[model samples]
Target: MSQPSPQPDRAAGHNPRSSGPGRLIIALYAVFVVGSLSRAGFQIATRFQEAPLAYTLSALAGVIYVVAAISLALPGPRAWWVSLAAISTELVGVLAVGLWSTLDPAAFPDATVWSGFGRGYLYIPLVLPVVGLWWLWSTRPGTVQD
Candidate 1:
């Protein structure tokens, strides 16, 4: 006499990461996608000879941002795993590049998105992955009790 109920996950507090603050994280990722890609595009196009390594690294960071954003927005266990990988990579990238750039400034005359621990962008790129990883782990499937 009545229609079927919604999915159990929805009825419970097992919300999707794409919802709530997760959306904010995704939005931040989108911003990084634009910033990193545009910067890389401009550098690679107009000043490739000036700083090829930095520009290329920026482009790579942009691609990683794109992947992380999409994976976070997607809904599924597979997507969660992908988001995990992408965010982990981003973290490692920021840390490694931060140290490398700090140690060898000459190697990077310019700056990638991950350089200086994202100091150019107020270090958001450095902290974003940590937040994302925390969000994912906390909101992981079946973890929400309420």
Candidate 2:
């Protein structure tokens, strides 16, 4: 008679690799995803014609945030790569839009998610992408893989 094999520890819902900061990051990303998407929906539905460029940009940012959030929540190398790409694009978008809005207020006329470095959101939009990129890099294969 052989002894039974021990089941893998699954005490918490969280994966072993996704404790602490990783979970926190994921939660924040989820919040941003929802916020961006909701804002974009409102902007596009209510007054898209008023500032087409800004509204379009808002929509794009929302999509990117959603993708990044989902990718980060998933567990795999592919997800990591996708999240990295999304976050990098987000960083570039925020920087470019922030500078453009600052240099020429008339150009915006209406604010996008990246306008003024996301001042409306207290610059979290600007900083989030940087943190996300770092997190993804840290979780890369051959690294911690979290």
Candidate 3:
């Protein structure tokens, strides 16, 4: 009789087994999720009138970050695609907004998370998406694959 191939063990629920860089990526994502959401909420509530466009973009960025974080944390193929899409969109958004802000300061009297490549936030907003994409790519099946 032929022996059966062993099945890969998956973590319970959305949680993945914390090992190597997975744990670090999850931690960073969680922090960004909270940070983006908090900044967006504060901006929208306090001085949204000052820069409606910037504030709205901040909120949108927050939503994207939250979705990416959740999807990355989850264990499954669906989560991978979700995270990839969110991260890619985020990268594009930051780049476009950053360039626009640089070219036309008048358009954005106030700053956004993506302004100047997230200069106020120490460029984490700019770098986060790159890291996210790399992490997702690394975790793809056949490679590290999370």
**Would you estimate the TM-scores of all the predictions?**
0.89, 0.84, 0.84
Index of the highest-lDDT prediction:
1
**lDDT (Cα, 0-100) at 140 in candidate 1:** 82
Candidate 2 lDDT over 56-146, as tens digits, reads 8888988888888778777666677888898999999999999999999888889988999999889998988888887777767555622
- Kindly report which residue stretches of model 2 are placed more than 4 angstroms away from their true locations once superposed: 1-18
Whole-model lDDT, candidate 3? 0.80
lDDT of 3 by residue, 1-146 (tens): 99988645564443342346667766776777687778778888998889989989888888887888778777777788888898899999999999999999999989888999999889888887888787777777445533
Clashing pairs in 3: 139-145
Backbone clash count for every predicted candidate, in the order shown: 0, 0, 1
Give the per-residue Cα lDDT of candidate 3 at 27: 77
lDDT-sorted candidate list, best first = 1, 2, 3
Best by TM-score: 1
Tell me which of candidates 1 and 3 scores higher on lDDT: 1
List lDDT for all candidates, in order. 0.90, 0.80, 0.80
Q: Give the runs in model 3 whose Cα sits over 4 Å from its true position.
A: 1-7, 11-18
Candidate 2 achieves a global lDDT of: 0.80
